[model samples]
Target chain A: MFKLIESDAPQRRRICEIFVDGEPCQAMIGEPLAAALLKANCVPMRYTPVSGAPRAPLCMMGVCFECLVEVDGTPNVQACATPVREGMHVRLIHGARSIGQLGGAAQ
Target chain B: MSTFDVVVIGAGPSGITAALTAANRGLRTALIDEQLSPGGQIYRNVDAVDNGMQTILGPEYLHGRTLTTRLQHSTVTRIQGASVWQISDDLEIAYLQAGVSKTLSARHLILATGAMERPSPMPGWTLPGVMNAGAAQIMMKTAAAVPSGDVVLVGDGPLLLLVGKQLLDAGASIKGLIQTSPIAQAGKAMRHLPKALLAPGYLIKGLRLLTHLRAGRVPFFRTDEAVNILGSDRVRGVSFIHKGQRIELTVDTVLLHHGVIPNVQITRMLRLEHRWDVDQQTWKPCCDGHGRSSNPSITICGDGAGIAGALAAEASGAIAGLDACFALGNLSEGERQKLVRRPARAHRRQLRIRPFLDTLYRAPEWLSAPLDETVVCRCEEVTAGQIREMARLGCKGPNQTKFFSRSGMGPCQGRMCGLTVSSILAAENGVSIEETGYYRIRPPLKPIPLLALSQARVARSAGTERNSQPNEDPTHE
Candidate 1:
């Protein structure tokens, strides 16, 4: 698991609970979703569609879509680019996301 | 739909400077970026970063706050969290804002999109625990987070050394650093030392970072070998050769870096003339002294124009901004000439160390040109061997390789693997990278949702739309 060192210690950040794969994880408000997931030791954000190989945030920037995750039933969202919020729901992408799982539930 | 006299695509040092210069000069300017904050990646979360993080991230990063603070006081409109999906030649920009599509028109566009780490797709790079050194830098800059346990950084370039020092400062246990800068290349860099010494501060900083890494008890091995990250699904360790002897280290995470290159998605999509930069080993838009591309309406400054660090980008940004103002009739010929002198001089002065750096950490063919079983395109899962086979089949260029192997047709749109494929194909075809060429970039450049794209089409009102403005008519071309 990656270590988070008292992040943003000087600034009093609003901490909230977010659900990932139906499990509760503590997240800082407005922090990147990928960072929060990494801090929570939840790597392997997605599996490659071609080889089903597990992949995590490679660049932590938007360029490498290796950090693609499903948030609130929306598929292929970049966790590195998106911000965490209270009661946010995230799911790791297992290879190609079907339209059913995605459902485009959150616009 | 909103309109801007000048639309700056990136909010980094260069973009900010360009926006401020144009806005302060009475042109309507809007600076857009994907980050949640004002500063781009170099200064990610400048305002939110605590004092502790600031000390750990170092002074160069802290310097971003000054630019952002000045940006806050300026009249420039700062738009954050917007992923620009498309940029037309006519300066019609379409982007996704909070999951919805928004289109804006601009008289002039300045893209300070900045530089991205060169894609080093060695064996096991697609694994979960292996990432770029810049990613580690990003994690630290944004959240003060670091990989725990044994961490090994493998590659060459000033960024690798800088990240090693930063990770050590953040209290991360760096198990080792495997530098792949060839000894022969190091000898070549010696020739450029005199010219590089003109910018002594850069060399001094390099020395300081190396010293810090040494003081941290981190082992360093400069191997003229392509380092391999050995793992089934996650990084277990790294194995490489040193002096005809194989050396291996146990590690939890592997970070790779080999300098950075201009991010040319916008320029490529616009089809502005690009030349393969042999020194930096990447494609850069052919721009004038003021960063103006073949398309006079667009200007690319900063690393997006080329990898001329932050200070150089700031100067180039000023030049680009001043040029834009002059083009838009804000400054007379005499006024523009006088205003351009300082930034122009500063730009040249700041880039004095580039040749030394480019040669010292040139992109190693052995590292980037992967072989059988090594993945080239992450999205499509195309292997390097497959791409080589495509080249053997007489594929015309990178565009044909797309149909042959589906390498560049992934969701990432070839951002992660384009350069690697280019190198592999070039080597296989016995041609220079310049001759092999790069992937043909198109919109949506950043992978916007299909739903958003459809919605945007439905709500379209620009050049191609039904109620199009006469000035924005499709036949204007």
Candidate 2:
């Protein structure tokens, strides 16, 4: 579990609401989506296809693929690399994502 | 496709200094980084942080703001949130930004991708509540976040103590610090004390971090045996030997780290010659004192080149920047030599203490070579036993293990498991880690979506059309 601590100096950024697993969650505008999710206690960002083991962000620097979450219907987005956008739809990925999931278009 | 005179690939201390130096010399430089802001991992989000947070992060972190602020006023282009997926030997770069693919051709390239925490795999490390201590620090820096429940820090290195102190100062209810440093190596490390005394600031700072934790009266433990981050879905507790007797402590989060290694995936993808450093116990791309790699056009600096700390990275970057200016004909060779003297001296002073620190914090063997059932490859859920079995079955190295068990073939492309797998294979075969070569890293360093991959062609064609017919109506799109 994680909590967002108030800095001694007041924050000067905007806050926005994003959807996490179909639930409304408040997130800082332009901060990492993974940080927002972790603040909301939304761990286990992905399930492994091989053994179905639950995983969350290991290396927040994007070296580990453990935090691959489906963002706005696009599967396999690195949560740490992705910034929080207003009304962004983020769903935890389950196993190997099918190419046809959500509204994906072929290359 | 060419857009800039020089393109720097990261915005860490090194990249920031490099870009600033190049731009100051009249080179149209652009710095591409994956972070939301400049100040790669070491000083990440340094500009956004306020004065109150500054004191908590320490003077070293505040050092980044000077560079970031300087870059903000410079003519250099700072492209944020860019995932550089491909870089060619000829200096063609492709990166995905906001789901759009863009390409840049550069006369010179500086890769300062920086370092990543050496994954010291322990049992149940794949659990949800487990993470790199560096990750927690990033969250704290970028989001003002901190662990709310009971936290346990596992592993060795000064970073572990620094993180423990930072988290404790941030009000984390740290359970205990489980040290995995090979204390047996302290004698060897002591032999380097005279040389380390040349750089007194770092040694004192490391002790200060430890002293801070000790003053806080936080519980500290050292483990010689294997540690188990006991949990099913998330971290529930930790199981390890406290003092010849196995003990279990209930905990909510487990942060593991064993120092950091050069993030050489970019260099490896470029097919640069790399050597396994016996001291650092990791793969480092071969580069000169001035940060020139095998490819003449590409320059490497900062921790990405090796495991030199942030201070050394900046000095190395300054020296590299001077060399680049000389190469681009912006500075005379004599002038470049004259300018490089100060930063070169600073780089040497910063690196003088590395041997003492490296030997003191060498990660124990048990941290990497976990029990047979312990999961080593987080992506594929491959166990340590599977890797050893593959080695016994005559898998030459980490590459062959990929075909035999798919340990290193997942989305991460072996960043998390590559080093650990090498250690496992080396132990199983009784060969040196240098002989057990690393996985062959390929392009698309960061995985790109198929849509973005296709966008590369579209972006390139549009650029070609615009350049080929300059007189035609510019609004044809």
Candidate 3:
């Protein structure tokens, strides 16, 4: 319900289905994955790790990492930066993410 | 490593212009950007945005279309969707593209990486529906999306008014516009009117936008006090004092802005010398008029150089491009001067209104040094009080504060919280922002997969082995 404006501009029809938090959602091919999710009313994209606070896409540009979400098994991927693809799986990041053993203990 | 005569990082107004100028001057240029297409934030999705949206964005946005087209047609090697993670002092640029880490070298590197909205650290700013006004503009420009329900715009600056007007035209229901610019600043801003009139187009556009906002019947409040966003999980309402009266608006979305500062992550990471701009109250790289930074090979242009707006960025970019060409012996001194004369005049003219604007919309101190409870660093969840306490306890500077509180050590690499932390430290410690200093930037500038880095290293070594002379150590040099 947060989609205020409806564009009459020609848009590529929704040609792909992606999973958001294990739920299948229709998305337009080649659009930002965040836009697709926002259109689907996925407002709270992720929860901050420290405060457990809900956060959504702030700057769709890559500068503000508030849009950080897990995409296709990769944690902390920016939803706004990633283009939607067929069968893309996006999961809401709940808390602090470990960069696995390879990221080193300091990070 | 693939090397080019010039490597332009960014595809915005300045980067595109720089690349075009360099390539046209017979330099082997490579233009790199993180977006899938050209046209940085100001003209995002320029090629794809429809005519209706174009009208809403105005002529400034339309200008990018021509630039994008020209860059696309140019001989410059265009690299889109590249997240540049590192730039060594030796002009080695490393980036991640399609899950692959690659490195390239350039003789002359032009950084046109533009500005970002100043960090707004008011209470409840970290709420879900709370975001930068520029973010809302990006939503409209890139995704053809707008926030539904009651939206309250908070803060001040030219961008706030622009976004508010655009939102109104796009039919978004703005509950109220809370202008944080103090009423007294208007009188101060008037001092530069004669100089500002030199660029009449911008003045006219600004007046027109104001007229539209006034006609749209949106409630406007001018105040200097802090506006508190109310919500736990998401923005529910905004409460503030306006004209000696308290008012609260029920709103689901809150857009905040307080002007923009250069996105200096890459520049800082390169360890270039930077100076604090007292007027802008931000650290910008020390560069000559032609945009050449402390590093002779690296040139900083556009908003990345400083917030001189898009027109100045374009002009400065051309000047920088020509300077690089001259440095490379591509142009004679006389020819370079001739080429720079026009852009220099235009750049100066475009910059005429900035002093007045910067003075008029100077962010109130409270916005930067929010209340104790307000979160200062979103990544680390460091509160303003916590940062202040550390500063008082002899934290010294941003780098020291980082060790004490881990504020700037998050994924954002101090982008979101650097300014706030530094200013708060400066304020608390009774020192200038320069003395308080900034985060010691490190690389990889952005997060990159370890596997990709290893693969890139392997590829680099393989290429070196294949090309090295019998007695030469390719890795050493």
Candidate 4:
């Protein structure tokens, strides 16, 4: 079921604006959101509780949720696991600190 | 790299079987295994606390009992706890063990790394208490620890049902069993239900477990899906969306599982040709009746080929062992024929149950997982949305995805996400999952430390190099 279609590079370059941390990030049309953010080096996908360790991608295929980042104001979207949208907004979950910070309620 | 006539990676059923067969036939064998003991993940031995007996059954006890004892008697040189990283064309293996690097080489190689749980992701799946069912079983088998408090076992594979029984047996409270598929698929595959009734005792064990759960008035939700796992740190509860309605259940432990995908890291590393099996959600090494791979010098067997359960793995191992003997010129034509025929029948019998499993636990379309703003590659933190966009932009294949998005390029390599990513790629391109094969596996088979490996090779070749090296030979001049 695989078809190799030639896409017009100029036309494929449709521009879209997505917000990351209230900052507008320009992205190409038909590109995943994670790629744009990664290209921009906007990491620390999610924050841990105890040590407040920043965890990014662990298992790229969605098996592990280490790359989860908040999208559109919702917390815990697997950034590496999910695709990029034209105008998606992503936010980092900040309450937790480290593996040690796990016990306390979301501060 | 220290080369041998044959290298068998993994101490599991297939690797041990291949090593024993090859070595007994006088092919110099190097058996590289990951665990301290030979048994693979499924038959991992339990570490005892004191004098308390660890009761074992099913594949754990049966395969462990026989394979472990056989490995002890084999001529194979076993290297334990070796984590292979890559395999070269010369059959050289780079691996890490006990914080040391090492390398080994072989002319002919066999891989039997086996399988692991296929992690099916859902919303809130990242919650701390959400664990794969196999991981739960492994803990019980190896560490004798159960998920504390009320536990809910979800999914419909026979393993889930059996594990539920094991958990109950281990004195853990089972809140409910969530079966995602109907039981008729199981019943249909077992056409000779009355005769081989005892052979498929695992089904009965499942039924018994179901009956006990029912009789005990334990709640069970069938044809359901775990929509989300709720809790900030530890698992507080799980929301089951049944028939489009969300019902939150109070449970601290959420055991989630779908099925297993073949662990083909070592096999793929050898550059063995493979085929995608849509039913099992994994790639299997291409093998003929004799378990010989595309590389004539290499062979594969057991779950690495497919998930036919332990008995089938053993039967396949025996056949593979016999074939290895043939390759080594140790088997007479008659002996090989006799040994091979019996196991072929056993394999046929095992195949009967697979159709049922395939129909019953068909990876729910809902679980196909849509391209969202979620991360698809946890190692690189790549998102599915990114992968799809790349695919549209010409990152058409899993390999291309790896190159462009670093999707399958990570520490666990692609072990944890390869199957899911392949499925996603296939879906994106409107192709069957079969069309999108698994990510290529290269080996040491396990990770290894460089200094130790070099030291070992150096120690082994100390005397021989002086005699064989042309530069060191005074007579050559």
* Candidate 3 local lDDT, residue A98: 56
A6 Cα displacement, candidate 3 (Å): 2.7
User: What is the C-alpha local distance difference test score of each model?
Assistant: 0.84, 0.85, 0.84, 0.63
Tens-digit per-residue lDDT, B1-477, candidate 3: 899999999999999999999999999999999999998999888887744577788887888888899987899899999999877545778889988988898898899999999888888888888888998888777666778878999888889999999999988999888988767778988997888888748788888878899899988887678898898778889888887888999998999999999998988888789999988878899999889898888888899999989888888889889988987889999999899999899899899989888888888878767899988888899999999999879888999989988998888889999999988998999898888889988877888977777776432231122354566443453
TM-score of 4: 0.73
DockQ of 1: 0.65
DockQ of 3: 0.55
TM-score of each candidate's B chain against the true B chain? 0.95, 0.94, 0.95, 0.85
Q: Find the number of clashing residue pairs for candidate 4.
A: 75
Per-residue alpha-carbon lDDT of model 2 for A8-106, expressed as tens digits?
A: 555565689999889999998877898889988997777887878888898888899888888887878899888898999988877765655554332
Give the range where candidate 4 chain A is weakest over 10 consecutive residues by summed lDDT.
A1-10
Q: How far is B296's C-alpha from truth in model 2 (Å)?
A: 1.4
DockQ of each candidate's interface versus the true one? 0.65, 0.70, 0.55, 0.02
lDDT of 1 by residue, B161-216 (tens): 98899889888889898888777888999998998999849999999988989999
Winner of 1 and 2 under lDDT = 2
Q: Write the per-residue lDDT of candidate 4 for residues B190-269, one digit (tens) a residue.
A: 65454444455555665786786677666778654435667765567877766567778888667777777777766766
For all predicted structures, in order, the TM-scores are 0.95, 0.94, 0.94, 0.73
Q: Return the lDDT, model 1, position B119.
A: 85
Candidate 4 docking quality: incorrect, acceptable, medium or high: incorrect
For model 3, the docking class works out as medium
Residue A107 of candidate 3: its Cα lDDT? 32
- By TM-score, the better pick of 1 and 3 is 1
